[model samples]
Structure formats: structure tokens, C-alpha cells
Target: MSSVVDSTCEIREAQLALQRDGEELEHVEFTINSLYAEIEVIPKGNCLLQEKRHAVQSRIFTNSARISPVRSLPTEILQRIFKVCLPDDRYVTPDIRSVPLLLCQICRRWREVAEASSELWSSIAVYDLSDKGSYTAMVTRWLVASHHRPLAVSLSCRDAIIFHEFPLAPVLRWWSHTQHFITFVYTATISGLLD
Candidate 1:
């Protein structure tokens, strides 16, 4: 489970890195092309053209050399990077997995990193999911790797009152012992409100 979470985290970082770098590359290319075109038509003694060209060239070189700072990130920095990968919300309907929690999508190394870093994936938020079996499994992995650290969980109204999510019963039973750690959201029902 740890390995699964780790890989998922790294893969997520890779994908975001690719998207960000790709955009920067495109912007740089466009600026360079526009400058080069203007330089061709500039008059012989144009100081503006010379300065613009120099600036563009400098930026091009700087950006080219820097594919991404993450490429050479230290271990502490990398862990920090993974921390943001975890989204505050967990149950987003179709996407069961959180952004930072999906490092397996990036590559093998990231997957390993995420798995090894239990804290990265220990946070959980309950919403509409009916089954807790899978969650229990995930919790176990997190519990073991979390080194006795308490896990963070957000309790939402839907999951607060034992919504008949069949899977939840087993999980509740399993965690009947550690119920205090998780946050459960609750709202007043019509009957409760009336009363």
C-alpha cells in the first residue's frame, strides 16, 4: 500500500511538471520567434532591437537550462513537494484518487517514493462512498507506515451519520476502536431541525 501511494504521488508530480514546463517552453518559443522576426526587419543602428534580442536570448538560455527545479530537488524539498500533492478533498465522485495520491501515474521512481512516504497519503476525507472495505485496507497501510502518528480525516455530513454505505459498516466496526481521530461532518435532518 505504501508503494502504491508513493508511486501515485511521484507520477502526479511528473504529470504536473510536464504540463507546466510544456507551457513555459511554448511561451519561450513564441517570444523568440517574434523577436527574431523583428530583428530581421530592424534598422542597422536600432538600440531597442539589440536590447530586446539580448534579453530574449538570455531568457531562452536560462529557461533552456532549467527544465525544472524539481529535477535536482533535495530529499526534504521533494517531501515538501509531495505534501502539496495531497488534495484537501478525497471523494470527488468519479476520481476516487486524489491528485498527489496518484504518483503511480508519473513513473516507477515516484511510485516508490510515495509508497515509502506514508504521511503523504495518510489523510482521508469521507463523503459519498458507500463501502469502507477498500478504505480500511488503505487505512491499515497508512497506520503501519505512519509510525504511530495520528491520521487526519475530514468528516462530512453525508458520512457523519452512518449513511448506509454497506462498506462503511465493516470499516466502522474495524475502527470502532479508533473513532476519535477522524472528523465526521454532520448536519441537522428535517426531523432533528423540527425537534
Candidate 2:
């Protein structure tokens, strides 16, 4: 019967498909086994490479023992060098690139030296004291840096009209306790400025 023939063809097609699937499965299994073998060897090679890198780093570190010529100097000599960096006869503006502050930024060693040198921070100048809050903070820092030493402060009144506008009471109170306080105020005329 034609039905029986159709069934026979269907059975043959199914068997061919099963054989194809079995071949594909075997190919997939081979690929997976190959990847597993590669993975097993990878850790050994990776560990060896890591060890080689660490050894090279150690050698580099040993060779770089004398990286900076300045580091060889004694602390006393270094402190003198830091002192020479400051302005000899001028006020240090609140600038980022100036001597004492810049020295602090150079490295930890320089920072310690600059910080320990109280004379470097003893001189302070106020070009404009309009901002009382900022002036307070700056004065506080200068006092701390002076380490109970005398302070040489210069106050410049840019505008006589705005002189009363500034907070002078707090400034007076802060500098009162200083042992040796030197204050210089530059003005064209002090006639009615206080009024």
C-alpha cells in the first residue's frame, strides 16, 4: 500500500537525521575537550609569566635606589635649602606657585622641612581685608605656622571709604595676644578714615 511506502520513506529520513545529529554531537564533544585541555595548561603558563614580571619589577626597584640626588642631602642642609627658597625681603602672597607652599607640594620630605621652619610662615600681608571670613582663616593659619614666634604682618587699606566696612574688631582681638606683633598700614591719609 502507498501508505506503507510513505511510512518507510519517513522512517529512512528520520534515521538519516539521527545519524547527522550523532556526527554533530561528536564534533561538538571534540571541540569542548580541546578547549578543556587549553584551559588546563593556561594557569601554569600564566603563573610563570607573573613570576617573571615580579622579578623584573624587583630588579627595577633595586636599580632605582638613587633616583633623586636631592634625597641624599642631610635634613639640616635640606632645611637651609627650603629657607633659601622663600622670599628674603618680601611678603609671600597666597599663591599656589610661591616658595613655602610650593616647597610643601614638591614632596613629603620638603613638606616636613617647610612646615618645621617657623620663620618661613612668620611674614604675612593682607592686600585686601574686605573678606573678613577669609582673612580670619588666613591669619589663623599664619599664627599656627609661626609656632608662637613673632609675626610681621602688613595690612593695606585699598579704599578708605570701605575701611569701616571691614571687620577690624576681630582682627584686633586675634593679634592682641601675639608677643611681638609688627603691623604696618599704608594709607595716603588717615584723616577721616576711621569715621
Candidate 3:
């Protein structure tokens, strides 16, 4: 084999490589410090931004809350409002003048509250006790509307009224819980109403 001699070139090449590596190390150190400083500032800046965002959101929520007049009302006041919407008489139907029916029509919440309320349906007035289908249905509905609460019934009939023949079965069924309060006496037909 022939002897090779490249030691001198090899040494020079090694020294040049060392010099470049030293410069690269210094540049890397500088870049690392710059990045560290930026990293520290970014979190603080983000924290301030977040604080501003939350403050603005809070102000917007407060302003929105101030706009609702009914939302701020207490539960007691809301209950009173519901009570005022009830009719003076106890028995009611879907007539426009019927308070319970009207209140139920206004909203879902009103319907729930009205239907469950015993006081609102405690007073019922029966204009007639005839065996006619509609009148019997109305009387039955009024009794059911009371919902186990004590009832005040007003019974009156214009013509000759008879107890056994009249639609008094449902009323008599609830007689234990009912009190006949008002009686409109006619000429000759409503004797069995109070009984």
C-alpha cells in the first residue's frame, strides 16, 4: 500500500470547524435570551387583555339586567300580580271576560299557576241546575276546578226547579266540602238549591 500524508490539511480543517462552532454557540445564547424575554412579556400582556375582556363583559351584563323591569320583581310581587288577574267570581270558563281563562291564555306560566291555584276556583255560581247537557258539564267542571279546596256555591234557577231531577248529583257529591253562600230566590223554582 502507498503511504498517504494529509495530516496538515486535516488539522487546519479541524481548527476552522471549531471556530465556526464557537460563533454558532454565541449566536444561539443571544437568541435564547431574546426568546426568554419575549416569553415573559407575553403572559403579562395576555393577563391584561383577559382582565379587560372580563370587565367589558361585566358592564354589558349589568346594563342588560337594568333593562328588564319585570325580571327584577320579587316572587311576592309576582304572586300578587297573578292574584289581581283572577276573576271576582269563582266559576269561570273560556269567555273573554273570564279571568282565570284569560290568564291561562296569556302564557304557559300563567296557565300552570292558575290551574293549580285552589283559591281562584273556590267560588262557583250556578245560574241553573237543569239536566241540559251544557249546564251539567259546567257544574261538573266547576266542582272539579275547586281542587279539593272548600267551595262557596251560588245556586239559582228561574223556573220550577226539582232536586231529584236536577243535575244535583255532582254538587251533592261535593257537599261535604262545600258551603252554600249566596242564594238568589226566584218566584217558584229553586227550593232544592240550598238543600
Candidate 4:
């Protein structure tokens, strides 16, 4: 009878230990689940933080540009700066890659300043009169942009006949009325004749 009682007590103790271990396992599983939820949120939170940082940086850059020295320069001083940037060539070509046209392309304010500065458009060289139609229109626009400022026009052709064929109506009209000093340079290469 005493052996039976001892067996029963041992069995009860084993059951209690198992119950306690099961409760501890449940607590560990709960903790793991909570950690997984926090991990999932971290990436989303980090993305939001990054977006706000980018926005702030962009604003700082914009504000800094607004206070730049070049932006604050007077229009007259800016025009002088544009003049200084003009090409050393005898006459300005309508090439968009060069200074005066390049200056106009920078921004609206710069375009306004460059276009208004008549001196920037006062000189032009047309290297090809083969496309007389386009050249005439281009020359007329260039002269008009000069706002009656004295013009230095350079025309180059392979044949003198091309020069005669070029409609000089626009140039003549400007020359007839304006008292401003005008310089005209004509160049022709009559291959064998020059040699």
C-alpha cells in the first residue's frame, strides 16, 4: 500500500512540472510574435523618415540658390557679363552652342536679359548662302533683334553669284534708314581664280 501511494505522488509532481513548462513555452511564443510585428514596422518607418529627409534637402538647395550672388546681380551688370562672354570671332554666329545664344538658354531671366541687350545681336556671320531662303530669314531675325544697333554683317559664298542671288532686301532696308555705322564683309572663293 505504501508503494502505491509513492507512485501516485510521483505521477502528480511530473504532471505539474509539464504544465508549468507548457505555460513557459506559450510565453516565449508570444514574445517571438511581438518581435516579428515590430520588425515588419521598422522598414515602413525607415522609408517615411527617408522621404522626409529628401524633401528637406531639396528645400535647402532651392533656398540656397535663391540667395546666390549671381541671382542678386543687377540687370546692367549681368548684361555686361554677357558681353564679356561673347566669342572672339569677328562676328557672332547664330550657333546655339556659343555664348549669346547659350546665355539665353540658361533660364527665363537670362533669356530676357540677353534678348533685351541689343549689342549681343549686333554682329552676325553667314557662312553658307547656298540655303539662301533660310539664311535670309535668319539674317532678318538677327538684324531685327539688334533693335537698330549698328550691324557687322559677314557673308561667305563659293560663288559671287550666290551673293547677288541673296535677297538683300532686309539689309538694304535697315541700311537706308539707320545712320548707325554698318560694316559689310563679303568673301567668295572662285577656286582657280584665287590660285
Clash list (residue pairs), candidate 2: none
Q: Model 1 lDDT vs. the true structure?
A: 0.58
Expressed as tens digits, the lDDT of each residue in 1-195 for candidate 4 is 999999999999999999999999999999999999999999999999999999999999889878888898999999999999998887987766776777877878998899899779878887765665855556555666676788787766666566556556644564464445478876766674554
Q: Which 10 consecutive positions of candidate 4 have the poorest summed lDDT? A: 170-179
lDDT of 3 at 111: 63
**TM-score winner between candidates 2 and 4:** 4
What does the lDDT come to for candidate 4? 0.78
Model 3, range 121-148, lDDT digits (tens) per residue?
6666666555567656655655565666
Q: Top model by lDDT, which number?
A: 4
Over 55-167, each residue of candidate 2 has an lDDT whose tens digit, in order, gives 99998976675586788888889878878877766666554477666777777778887778876886777666566676555556666667777667776656765465555
Could you tell me every candidate's TM-score relative to the true structure?
Answer: 0.40, 0.53, 0.42, 0.55
Ranking by TM-score: 4, 2, 3, 1
RMSDs, each prediction?
Answer: 29.4, 8.0, 15.7, 8.1
Order the candidate numbers by lDDT, best to worst. Answer: 4, 2, 3, 1
Instruction: Give the lowest summed-lDDT range of ten residues in model 3.
Output: 179-188
Candidate 2 CA-lDDT value: 0.72
Those runs of model 3 whose alpha carbons end farther than 4 Å from true positions after fitting are: 1-76, 87-96, 131-139, 161-164, 167-171, 174-195
